[model samples]
Structures are given as C-alpha cells and as structure tokens.
Target: MPLYLLRISSEQTSFRIPSLLSIAQVFDFPIRFVSSDLFRGVLVVELQREDDVEKILERDILVLSATELFAEGASYDELHTELRNNMALFDPYIHTTFRITMESCNHRIPETRQRETINTFRYTGLQGEVSMKAPQVEFVIVEDYEWEVANTPEARYARDGNFVRVYFGRRIGIGRARSLILSHSVKTRTYYGNTSMDAQMGFLMAGQALPAPGKIMYDPFVGTGSMLYAVAHWGAYVFGSDIDGRQIRGKMKGKNTRPGVYRSAAQYGVEDRFIDCLTYDVTRGPIRRGGWVDAIVTDPPYGVRAGAKRLGRKEGKKPLREDPYLMDDGEYSHQKPDYLPPSRPYELANLTLDLILLARWLLVPKGRLVFFLPTVNEDYDEIDIPIVEGMKELKFGAGSVQDFGKWGRRLITMEKTALDDGLPPTFEDHDELELTKASGKLPGHYGFNKRYAAGFPPRKDGNRSESATPPNTTLEKREEGME
Candidate 1:
C-alpha cells in the first residue's frame, strides 16, 4: 500500500477525521491510515487506488490538499539522507519542468534559505527548468515544528524551534476548497437569517446526512434554507419546513419583495433541486408518511438567536368573528386577510423529542438523520443526546465550540435501522431535559444562562457584547423569550 499525504484545514479539527472516515465508507473506499499528526494537520493513509484520491477530494470539504509522499524524516540530516538514497523516485521528474512549494507549522523560512534548501536537490541528478509558471510537476515540502517553543535568539542558537518532522511529496490533487468559494457561501446568497448555518458547516452536515446523489433531503427547521442549499449542491432534491412564515417568505414590504429560500436556490443554479419549502412547524408532525425521505439535515433552534415555538393556546385570547364577505380574495381590500395562528413557547425537551420521533417516522432504512444539539461545554454529555428507538448511532461529536466560553454544539448523525416496534425511548435522566423544566434550584440549571450566553451574549437592544458573563439578572431574565 502506497502512502498518501492529506493536508486538512486547522478549523473544526474534530470534524475532519470522522467526516473523512464516513465519506470513505459511503464511497466503499477503505481509509487505511499509516500515520497521522493531528496537531500538525497531516494524515498519511493508504488508498485502494490512485483514483480514490479524487473520490475523497469530491466528498471532503475540510481537506486542503493531497499528495503522493516521496520521503519523510524526523530531522534535516535524515531528510538529506533519504532524498539522496531515494534518487530513483525523482529520476522521472528531474529533467521535467517542476516547482517546489513549501509549508511549515510554527516556523517560517526565508526565501533565500528555501532556495538554498532546494539547491540540494539540484545537484542530485539531471538538470531541469525551474518553471515558476505552469510546471509539469509540483513538489511540496512541509515542516512541522513545536509550537510551544518560541523562536528566540537562545532557541535559535540551540535549534529548539527546528522542525519536529519534515515531509516531501508530489502534489496529486486538491479538495473542495475552490468549489466552496461560490456554491457553499452564504455571502453570495440573496437571503439569510440570524441563525443561518454557515457554508462550510452546512455543506459538511449535508455530506454526512445525505451520502449519495438523487436523494430526497428534508430539513424540518430550515431557516434561510442554508442546509437545503448544501444538500441541493450535493445533487439531492431538498424540501424543508419552517414554523415562521416570515423566514420561508422573507417579506413583502410594499412594492419590493425580498424572496426567501425558494428563490435563493436560483443563485446557485440548483433551483430545480429545491422541491418545496413549507411554513409549518415540525412539532405538529406535517410529514404523514414513513420511510420516504432519504436524509434529514437540520440545525434546530437552541432557545436563542431563534426562539423555539409551536402552535398552542394563549390565555385570555378571544376568538374573532370571521366574515365571509371580507374573506373573499378576488375583491379589492385594504389589506390581505392573513390568518395568524397563535404560538406558545415550546419546551426544549419536547422539541428534541419531536425531532427524534420525526426522524424515526420519516427516514428510510439506512437513511441518516444529522442534526445539531447545543450544550454547555462543561456539561456536554454524549448520553444526553436523544436516542430514537430503532435508529443506529453512526457518528456524534462536538463539531464546534466557543473559544472563550462553555458553549458548544454536537453533530449527531444516526441511521434508521429498523421500524419502531412499540414507542420511542424516554430521556428521563438527561441533564438538558431536566434543566429545561427545572428551576435555578437544580444543579445543572445554574449554568443555563452562562451556557446560552457563551456563543451569544445578552442583547442590549440590538448590540451584543463579546463578554461571556450574563447580565446581573437571573437565568429567568435570560430565558425570557428564548423559550
């Protein structure tokens, strides 16, 4: 098995490994790892075939570049010796037009020093044109150095900041970095919301949920259709539903109308892939059939940024009499007679339970249900995540976390394994479920405000400060409208 170098992005490091593994499984390509330095962002793996490089690249959104490793060493002396001994590998490219690209972790080398280093390879064999332009072959030199040690005068004297390991490879291919620039970006889209999922995360979630093309992807809480955009881009026909009609149908303010998710699909040239988007709440169970949708990719509201609400009763609300004459649509009226349904605060515990139940009822066999579950970093329990009766847990991990505070979201992907024989599993002991209904007197309820305030601070009118500490008010104040 030949070794290949996979260079992945530093951002969202936790997701990159599992995503690659899942993608390889979906494509039936085995990802046999030879070695990996997670901190240095390097992975050496063995692929079944050379063409599997392109297959991995097509699915992986985090991978930056891939290469066929020629030589690797722990020190400069070892690298020099290895290159000298491995002259046969470079024999074919020696006389051909080539360029050397250098990358380093925790170390920066001057161009003069790099050229001086490249000069060592020059004396190895036949002379070749050093084409800085388009080259017949491109070789890469990557160095990984200790990040904790600074490049001080004393450190430099002792070679303390020297590279820990060095890798030499010929560039074979790249990942979806370029494609994500246009197709996956929300900045390029016409519509977005406060809780709209970002392009990279959205696409990654879509990839995890819908592993194949021509699949029917559904997002019950599709705000701004961000996830739907990603799913559609991956060749899946997407349909979604949102409780708030304002999100689905942006707004019709006078003569100018701001179109929502449906029209936004045209920007990516995947308009046909977007089947429909309904203004219906997920808790109401709009999906009547079972085993229809191939995948469910959603970013549910976490009691902030977006409020979790469902149609319910309101106290002291009087029923208004409806006049048939006034309700006539063809007649010219001062305003459109839109029927507004009353909504109440939906319990977080019930909301998640509904999502799990919906996934169980709607997802086909082997179809994945990928969704995000927000939690406090300190209280993050994998067991707290809801378990559907018949769904098989595929992958679950903290996809992202706040740098300054104790807030994070886990990406839970489960596949439907069998039909529910009786009923869904109950989550009585789950800390999140208990905290949702309990008062501040409870143990876990104390950090509810702090956890919610981690990624998003309490809003002062419109502005939000970066501080993670909640305002002087109690957790009840922070939970005012979040429910």
Candidate 2:
C-alpha cells in the first residue's frame, strides 16, 4: 500500500469526508485512513495504487489535491530529520524537473520566509532543474496550525500544541474534481428557479448514487433537472418526474427567452444523457415496480420556499362543477387545455417514509437512494428516519448536516444491500392515477415546515415527545393491500 496526503477544502467541512468515502465505495476501491476523523483538514490514507488516488481526485469536489506522502512531523527539526532519513523517497524526482513549494493551513508563510525555508532543505542533495513554469513534479511542504488560529481567537478551544503537524509530499492532481462545481453553478445555468438544487450539493448527491456509463439514475422530485443534469454530466442516463409540469417544461412560454429543463442540460453539454423529464405525482405515478433503476437521487421539497404536493383535492372543498360537460374540442370540462389538476398538502414526514419505501422497490440490488432530510437541530434522531419491513436490506451509509442556526438539514445516503424477497408489492401498481385511494385526513406532524415557521423549539434530552413526532406509516397500513 502507498500512503498519500489528501488536502481537503475548508468549505463545507462536514460534507468533505463522507463524499470521499462514498466515492471509494462506488469505485470498489479499498482505502485505509490513518485517522477516520470527520473534520480533518488534511487526511493521511493508505491506498492500494497512486492511480486510484487520481481517480478519486477526479470526482471528489471536496479534495483540493492529492500528494504522495514522503514524511510528516510535529516540528520543523523532526520534519527535516525524517525527510533526510527517507532520502530514497526523493531519489526519483532528484533528476527530474521539479519545484518545491510551501503551503499553510491556518497560518500564512511569507514568500521571503518560504524561500529561506526552502534553502534550509538543501540537505537532500539533487542536481534537478528547478522549473517553476512547467515542472514535471511539485513537492509541497504543509504547515498545519490545527483548529485554533491567530485569526479567530474567540473560537480557540485550547492552548495550541507544539507545531501541530507538518507534511511533505509530491503533488499529483489539483482542482480537477472541484472544477465541476464552477461548471454547474446556479449562476451560470441556463434554466434555474428559486428552489433549484445548489451546484455543490447536486454533485455530492449524484456521486452518492454511484453513477457510471450504462447506468440509469432518476429523481422523483426533480426541479429544473438540477440533480439529473449533474448525474448526466458524470456519464449516467438520467430521467425525472415532478408534480408540476412547469418545472420540467418552461414556466414562461417563449422561444428566445427559453426556460426548460433541457436548456440547463445543454448548458453543460449533457443534453444527450438527459433522457427525459415527465410530470407525475410520485405517490400515484404509473411506474412499475422491481429494481429497474440503478440509483435514485433527489432533493425533495421541504415546504419552506417550495412546499410538497400530492394529487388530491383539499378536504371539505366542493367541486366547482356538478356534472362533467363536453367542450368545443370534444374534451370533458375538466380536461380543458387550461385545466389544472387539484392537489393536497403532502407533508415531509410521510413523503420521506414513502420515498424510502419507494427506493426499496425501485432500486437495483446494491443501488443507492440519496436525498436530503431537513429537521430541527434539537428534534432529529437516527430512529426518526423512516424504515419499513421491505427496507430491511436498506442500510444507512452516511449523513452530513448543514446547520443553520437553530435548525439543520442532513444529506442522507441509504444503500440497498440486497433485494428483499419478503418485501411487499407496490401499492399504486394496480390503482389508477387519482387521489381517491388516499384518505383526506392530514398527519399530526407537518415536519420541518411547521417547526421552521414557528421557530424551532428545543427538545429536552434530544428526544421528541410522542405526541409531537409524526407517526410512522407502512405499506400495509395503506388501503392497497400487499399480497
């Protein structure tokens, strides 16, 4: 095994490690981390091959660069001693065109002092040409000031340890995977909405789906094709369905000022892989069950700016028309060109449970279900995650939280370990695409939406009261019985 130092971007520190681990699992590459700490700015890992490290860097947006670790130390004196002792590590690059550079994590190394430090490292005798412009290889010296730094004295947790850590390695790849973010940024996309998925999160979700050539990925709550576009960019054929046709098609009707899901895919040159975008209510859609999709990735509406909806009319509401009438185009009154289907509120709690159940029947063996779960910071728990009998083979892979003051949302990756023979059949398989199959009564819990609006109330001992939490629903509880 070869050791490598992975420099991670400080942005979205919580999202950094899980994404890397997901990439490794996708490629079936075995990696041994020196330490499995979640927020380590610099990671030291033992990889089977250097080429595998490059492959990971090419897909990971969090990893800034990959380097072959020659030595590390707690102090400059110890660092030089270790580097000198392992002179053989630098032997190959000795005759090759190379340049030496110094990098800092929480501290800055002045250029004059960096040159002075590079001069002191002349002990490892070499007669290589120093080409800063087009060096065949680059050797980097990293000085880590740890979590505490001179900038944020208020956040200092403890007294600074001596030197913290230092690493010496040869750089291999830089900014390759990270460049994908700039390519899909919402600011540059041709078609986007107020609730479009963020570029970075979309890339992370797509990666979690383990997309590859010949694989098919789907998004049930696709909006403006953000998630699918990213998946298509990674070589997967993507299709999606949304309750609102305006999201798939253009909200505004015009040719020159075009705004549709297809335009966004074309913006990134992935229109070919962006197979289709249809309109359907996920709860009652006409999708036949049985492990057909390779992966399911989506950012379901959380009822903040964009609320969730299902095909159904509001309770106690009277129909505008008493009897159906044929129109001039020989169509029913409700089937007019301007007719809009009626819908009812679909809360996050039940929608999330149904999504998990849907994944159990829709994803292939070992396929992954990646989505976001928004909850109050004080009310969230692993037990709160929805699970059913069919999801016995569904295992939680990773969860990364994006905290916002009193509340936070977690990006959840649930992988289907294997097909569940005892799993129940789909409910909507034999039913028509109508809300008559569902009850009009709404659940007690409205999920993050109601809580966010009322302002999150802190829970005692990090546990939710039974009356306050949403009751779990299963496939058997619905009217469509499983046989």
Candidate 3:
C-alpha cells in the first residue's frame, strides 16, 4: 500500500479525523487510517492502504490539518470522544522515548539544510514530550557535505566555515502560497488587499479542503493574486479578479511586474495559460455568469487598505471630522461630523454584504463561501446581514501577527441556502447595526490581524507569556544565526 499523508490544522484535529474517515469511506479504503501529530495542531493521516490514493482526488476532497478540522460545526467534547474512539480502533503504539540526532554539514550550509536541522531538533524535542514525559536523550552529529566545500580559489576565498543542522518540531500553515513555494527556488510575492496571512490562510485552508480537478476556485479580491497561486498549484482551475485595473493590467501585460509570480508559477509547473486573471469589481460587475463555481474563497478588504479609497472619499481625507459648534453663548460645543460617502468601514461592510448576496447569485446553491472577516473592536455580533444566513465562525486561536507579526483576523464560512423565503430583513443603515466591543486593544480598527488563531493562547493574556513559542521562532532564530 502506498503511504498517503493527510495534513490538518492544529486545533482542528477533531474534524480532521472524521474528514479522514470520510475520505477512507469515499475511497473504499479498508480498515483504519493511521493518524499522528506531525507537530502541534498538525495531524498526519497515513492511509492504511494507499492502493487507490488517486481515486480520492476524483471527488471533492480536503486534507485539513488538526487545527482547522473541528473549529467549525463541532464541539471540543465531541471531537475528543471521536479522537479517543479513533485511537482505540487504531491501537496505536505510543512512543515515549525521543532520539534527537543533530547532523551538521561542514561546508557553508544552505537555507534548506539549516531549516531541516532546526525542525528535526524541535520535532524530536517537543513531539517526544507530548507522547511521553521528556525526550530521553538528544544526540547531535556534524558531517561535511559537498555543498559546504569550495572547488574554486575565488569560492574558497569567500567560504566561511559553517555547519548546517537539521531537526523537527510543530509545523504550522505559512499561508498557502508560502507552503506551496517552500521547496522551490523561485521568489514569491503575495497579492492581497489586506496584507495579512489571515486572508492567505483562508485560501490555504480552502485549498486543503477542496478537491482538485473539475473544481473551479476564485478570489474576487486578488489584489496581487497570492491566493490564486496557492489553489492553482493543486491543479485546480483557478480564477482571480481585482477591482484595481492597474494590478490586472500589470499582471496580464507582464510589464515591469515582479518576476516572483511568474517565476513561482513556472517552478510549480503552472504556466500563465493555466491561470485566468481578470479585472472586475465584485460590488459593481458580474463574475462571468453561467459557470458553476465549486468554491468562492477570499479575504475581502476590511476597509483599511484598498477598500478605503472605494469608500467614496479622496485619499487621506478623514470620513469624520470634528467641528466647533457655536451656541448663543461664547462657549463652543464640538460636533461629530459625518462621512461624505461614509466611513470606509461602513462602505466596505456594505460591499461585503453585496458580495455575499452576489455570491449567492453566482454560486451553485449550497456552494461554500469561506472568507476572512475583519472584526470591529473584536466584536462580531455587529454584522447584521440577512443575506448571510447559516454563518459559521471559527476563531483562529492565534492571530496572523503570531506567525508574521502583522494583523489579527478570524475565519468565517457561510453556505448559500436555497430556502431564502424566510430570511431576516437586511439592514441598510450602518448605524442601525449593533457593534460588539472587543475586550482587548486590537492593532488597527481595520488592518489585517497579523495574529492568526492557530498560535493564539487559550486566554488573550496568556499569549504574552507564550510569545517565545511562535511557530516560526525557530526558523527566524536560525536565519539570524546564518546572517
């Protein structure tokens, strides 16, 4: 039997197992699929027999990491029970002792070598601790490799003796684009209206969730087409559109554009012919009707960046200004002014509502709309769009900043329903909608949340103490050492 690895998000282990089981049933695989945590929140499922691994791709398949698996539609208790049941069925052998072998190359180490060394070390150390008490012994070894040696005199003159080490630890999602380009030598650029990984993760998670071949995926807010590259790598018919004419023309024309997107595409074996890049505004234009879309996954702007200008105001102008009000007396009262078109947040909210409503018009009823919705003051209750019913929200434990240290964002999945007869009334007024006040101070009222949920602590304040344990800390530390 061929070995098949099923990767899922960290906290989503509960849903990942069931999804694996479902895949097993769909593929008609016999017996049980062995599952193990590759790292914290990352579950790897090895099919009991991989005889028909290719067949699973024929259906709409998703390989979720443990973190994103159960965040939606399931409770922790339910997932725990399922996990225990699955473990009982598998009769897995619990490995308590961890052997950590640190091997180093004598020559100047490549980036890949350094990464492998640190990852292996962390994995052996942390995973061992999880399975048993403490990883019994850590072994370190150093070896000289060909890449480390300089053959020419000039090369020898510039050579700095360095050892490349290898190890393993918890693996987290580095946005779909980063993960896809991890093994490649090409440069990568992410196109996003909201420059945050939260937007990228939704696309990444959706890419992991959806089946390849015959499935069509699109991102309406493909500011730079970052998400487009991720889904396209999985052999799906990827389509991307942005309201910005310049971005589309730049990408299409290939003039003075960053070579990363094209280079990465070539490296991934996806040529320009495979991707469909277009320019269109979801709020104003139609999304080429008559074709069925399997998934509409995107991160609409939070009215912070690109969407701010579209909020009907000139750039750099405040939506609300404070004006002095003179009464009969000499005393002046400060009056809060209103927006010319309205604040970008309100305008973007309306645009988002329009997109959701329009997505329903375009999507095959029951199609999934997965997106990263910005929270106002950390409050979600303020969203009062009747068009978006059956809303499922997943709080990514860690914010995007924990991984990239930028913005904090959340994941929301809403399914298009056919029974729209009894929907609630839509609120046209922005002021009428109830806004929820976040308990803690958020970075920006409208910027992308750099802190993703995967690395978030159970308590908001707990994150402060556990700040050093970020998923990419090892990588960052190693990079610094190399520099």
TM-score of each prediction: 0.80, 0.86, 0.46
lDDT of 1 by residue, 1-483 (tens): 778988877777767766777777667878776874553578888887878888777778888889898888997678878878887888788789888888776666667768777766665664678788898988988877665565575654465327778888899887855478566577767787788888888877877885466889898888789888878877889888887878888866785364577667887778898888887756665555677888999987767676677776554665433543344657534244365566766655456656766677778877888887765555444444446556655643333332335556667677777754234333222354343334222222123434475654432223212222221111211111101
Model 2 per-residue lDDT tens digits across residues 1-483: 889988888877767666777778778888877955646678898899987898888899888888899888888788898998999987887788888989877666667767987897788776789999999989998877765546554343233333478888899878588888887899988888888988888887788788888899999999788899878887999999999888777655656354488888877888889777888888878776568888889999988888989876776886545577777878896776466678877867667777877888888877788888886765554555645544532223334777886777687777665565234334332221122113322222334687777776543233333232233333222211111
Overall lDDT per candidate, in order of appearance: 0.68, 0.73, 0.40
Looking at model 3, how many pairs of residues clash?
A: 53
Q: What is the lDDT, from 0 to 100, of the residue 99 in candidate 1? A: 88
Residue 403, candidate 3: Cα error in Å is 8.0
Ten contiguous residues with the weakest lDDT in model 3: 474-483
Every model: Cα RMSD to truth? 8.3, 6.2, 17.3
Clashing pairs in 2: none
The alpha-carbon root-mean-square deviation between model 2 and the true structure, to one decimal in Å, is: 6.2
| Candidate 1 lDDT | 0.68
